[model samples]
Target: MFNDMMHILTTQSGDILTALREHILLSLMAIVIATVIALPLAIALMNHRRAGEWVLQVAGVIQTIPSLAILGALIPLVGIGTVPAVIALVLYAIMPIFQNAYAGLTGIDPILLEAADAFGLSKRFKLFRVQLPLALPMIMSGLRIAMVMIIGTATLAALIGGGGLGTFIMLGIQTNNNAELLIGAILSAALALAFSWGIRLLSKLSVRRIGVLLVSAVVIIGGFAGYRAINQPAGTITIAGKLGGEPEILINMYKDLIQADNPKMDVQLKPNFGGTTFIFKALQGGQVDVYPEFTGTVLQSLVKVKGSISHDKQTAYKQAKTLIKQQHNLDLLEPMKYENTYGLAVRQADAKRYHLQTTSDLLRQSAQMTAGFDPDFYKLSDGYPGLKKAYGLNFKNIVQMESSLRYEALANKQIDVTDAYTTDPQLKQDHLVTLADDKHFFPPYQGAPLVNDKTLQKYPGIAKSLNKLSGKITNQDMIEMNYQVTVQHKKAAQVARTYLVKRGLIQ
Candidate 1:
């Protein structure tokens, strides 16, 4: 494991460093904003006991909300990227800083305050010289706690394209890559501890020195942000993907393909940018120019077209393309020659014991089975709900769980069946077999390039370049690539570029 980790870090040093930098800037920015909002408010509320209590209660409630839930909720209103992520981090941060500041100020002796008053000091002068300085220890403690919390929580920012160590963590989880996961987790913990220790040292310094240090810190962070803005490529195209190894592989392929054909066209990839909703919102809000999407997802998730799609994948692709073009003004290029639809997976042992080979075969044992499904699968109209309706399956027990955990439970015999993407690498890893969808309850989920209409209009060659992938990728090809990334712990870009070069799609 150590050797594997060292190799990964050596080969992917640039990305790991970039992720660390993003994580640091994002966490620092949140802590700075939180301190700005919280410290003053904490002092102001100190004199108003009732208002302070109420405000603390509100902040506590906000802290109770799950970070993921907060991130998901903020997507529509604020869109993806640093804005929502920073906002969420700040929300989580406020309570600790505010509470500590209030406690510190209030805990100061009334005798000390009286001494300052007797000295004929102005309120502002008393605050700066006496009250604030005395309260500095507690305030620093609060800031330290907030900083540590935000640094850890900042990983979730990657889920919504906020760009942080969380990107590596999420990708690692999706691919079952332990080295990648450990690198993200260990680095986040290290960052938090370092920040807390630094804050402790700062608290020991005099107020004047602390002020000078803080000013210097602000300038450094600001300069970093400014440098990034100045150095970024002008008119660069952003290609994004949803959370999963396959999307990561596909997006890299998209990048390699476009750049191979149009060498000078600057393209940036945001692989595993987020889930369906988050990435789609970014696309709709014009944050991303293009991404690989599924025709069935276009119909079921985006277009709100209810009912079953056509039996034939080609016809389904046309239907989805037409509806999406007319309704959303987005263009979907030709689909790859593959169907990565949903399927019900079972343990290899169960398949033989129960004689289960298809959806119809499952009916014989439905009443005796306990099924676990991904939450999205359970909720989708054409997912578990539709599957139940189609096959008249009456599972003995049905439960909703995360997609990854469901597979584990199924393997452990805690669940008799679980929902799985047809091309998921875990299907091979666990030696599980998918029960054939003889009824074809789910729609054909054919992968295709979805481009923003305005972007395509501006860069007309983008459509041509992306469409080169149409009808080219086979199921076996995607499955192999996914296996390489997830099982072999190979880089997605390396696997994608290799495939493209092998097929003469790129040099």
Candidate 2:
């Protein structure tokens, strides 16, 4: 455990550093922007005593909205990426800075103002020399609070494809990989602590010079760092996806291939293990270069269209290829022969007791039992609601659990029936029986490589290598691979290499 922690800490230091820098830069930018606008607004409101309460009230209201909701709500209008994240942070940071600046300026000792007036100091001179200096400490306190808040909130930015430590945490939770979870959590906490300390140190060193040299230096240094990080050459190909049993193993395979083919190529694998929607958003925002996606998911969720094709491998693969290209300007590489379809799964004992041979039989008995499903499935069109409405099946209870945990729920009889993807290794490992979807409610989910168009174009050889494996892998093969990692304790790279060598894809 000690070694594991050290390994995680060492591997993640760069990412931790980067996340901290970005968080600090963003917070500083937001605070600076807010200070400029809010300070002046506060001054104007103070002059109009009647409107002062109204202005502060409005700012307070804006502050009450949760930061994540604000960021999510802005995605449609502003689109995904840093802009929305920054905007949300800025809005959240405003109230504190505004209120503090107002209090500091207005709460100044009346005798001090009188003394300046008695000395015949000009109004502008009194405002600048006396009022602004006295207000600096209070304004800085507001900034300090805003900075810390922004750092904590910035973790959610990864949901929209903005890169940060949150990326790893989401992945870890999805896959049930404690190692990844610890890495993300520890690193993120360290980053936040570092930023907090740095800011406090800066406050002490420059409390007296708040208006001039120190502030200018901060702006210049921060701008340079932000520019460098954003423009860093993206030599690495990052593969990210939702954490299902097999996908994580599959990604490791792809990463090994890329690395073996070109030692210079930096290949990074990020398994979301979260949900399909999270992984999809990450890909769309260019947070990852590639990931494994099902043909059915791409057709329904991504393309937002019903697939008219048959559930056969060929039909699904062809449609997926065309749809991905047209909709996302992405390339759906040759698909693996495997199909990971969604079906109703129950323990063998329950299946026998109910005489449930297919989905039709399960539907008849479902009303008396509890059902388990992945959380995101509740919101999807082809998920639980659609399943119930279409099949006329109603369960006594509906429980949402992670994909990794659902099998356990079924085994323990916590849920008599739960949704199972056809290719999940757990189906075979746990000896769970699946009832056929006779009504064809679920579309064929053929396994395929979903690649960024730019990546495909740049590395033409990648297409060739990936295509060779297409229509070759089966659901059984994927399950076995997943078992190798989760149960047998083999790394993804090793499993992938062994398979590739057996197929003559590599020496």
Candidate 3:
């Protein structure tokens, strides 16, 4: 584990550095925003005990909600990306900052106020000259607390398309790669300590110096953000991928194909962006230009077809393509050859004990078993719900977990069963068995590139370039590629490029 992490650190230095910068920038933005709102509000409510308690209680309530839950709630309102993430982090930060500021301002010695009154000082003069400087240390103490909290919470942001060191964390967890997880976790802890030290220094300085430091932080962040914006080329094509190894691999293939054909075109890849709903919303909102999707997913989740879905691959693809074009006005390109449909996997012990050879066989003992399914599988029509309806399954408990975590849980026997995909590399590991879908509740799920129509209109070559991969990735081929990435710890981009080159799809 240590060697793998060190190898990743050495080989993926550029990615780690980029993620560190992104994490720092996000944490700083939240800290600054929280300070701006909290300090002023605390000062305003310092004398109003009743009103101040009410406000503090509200911040406390917001703080109690899990950071990931807040981000999920904000998806429909603000959509996924940095904006919602920062907003969630700011919410978590306000409680500590405001409480400490209010306490500091209100708890000052009465002798100081009396002295100021003897001098006939204005309220504003007393605040800036007398009260604020004395309160600086206490207020900065709160900032240090808030800063540490923000830096830690910011890691969850990557789960919802908010990029940061959390991306490394999520990638590591999904691929079962200890190195990736360590990079994210260690850096996050380091950032919190660094900022805490910086805040400690600010507390000792005069109020004026603190103000200068705060302003400088904002300026530096703004400058960095502006520089990226300025450098982003016109007609830049942005591609996104859903969470997990498969989409990441596919999106890399898409980028490599486009670059191989049009060397001049600018392409950006947002891997592990999010789930089906979030990424689809990004496409509709023009946050992304393209992403990979499964045809069965479209019918089952997005479209929610009124009747039985087609069993045949081409038939299902055509149906999905037509409906998607009609409903969304987006293009669903030609699909790859493989069908990565969902399946139920269980521990070897559970299989033997319950005689679970097929989905229907689970009916006899399912009510006694605990099932841990991916969150997406829990919600999709072709997943747990459909399986339950078809096989009359009634598990004692249903737990929602992410794909990689579910696999670990299954391996540990923490869960009796979980949702597994046909091409999942984790499924290749021993001690787990995929139950036969005798009822065939799930439809064929062919992977395809779903592109925005406007984007295709502008970059017409993308469709042609991407089409070269149609009918290319077979079921075994995808399993091998995914294994290379998730199990062997190979870079997804390198794996993708190698496949494209060997297949003569790219030079």
State the local distance difference test value for candidate 1. 0.87
| Residue lDDT tens for model 1, 427-476 | 77788888889987888899999988989889898877788788888876
Ranking by lDDT: 1, 3, 2
CA error at residue 37 for candidate 1, angstroms: 3.3
Cα RMSD of all models vs. native, in order, equals 3.5, 5.4, 4.5
RMSD of 1: 3.5
Per-residue lDDT of 1-507 in model 2, one digit per residue for the tens?
A: 566556655755665576556555665666666666777787777567668778888878988887666765675566555567777877877788778878888889999989999999997888778887787777767777777777667777766555566766665565565676687777667766776676666556443465574468557856875896798667767787565447766787677667667778877766533456656665666666788888888877788556365566677677878877988888888777877888888888888888988888976787799988888876687777777787888788898888878888888878888888776666777778888877877778877888888887788777776667777877678778877765454556677778888877777
lDDT of each: 0.87, 0.73, 0.86
Q: Which ten residues in a row have the lowest lDDT in candidate 1?
A: 304-313
How far does residue 338 in candidate 2 sit from its true spot (Å)?
3.0
Cα RMSD, model 2: 5.4
TM-scores of the models, in the order given: 0.87, 0.72, 0.84
| Model 3, CA-based lDDT | 0.86
The regions of model 3 sitting more than 4 angstroms off are: 45-80, 344-419, 428-439
Lowest summed lDDT window (length 10), candidate 2: 205-214
Candidate 3 per-residue lDDT, tens place, 266-311, comes to 9988888867877887787677899999998888777756677897
Ranking by TM-score: 1, 3, 2
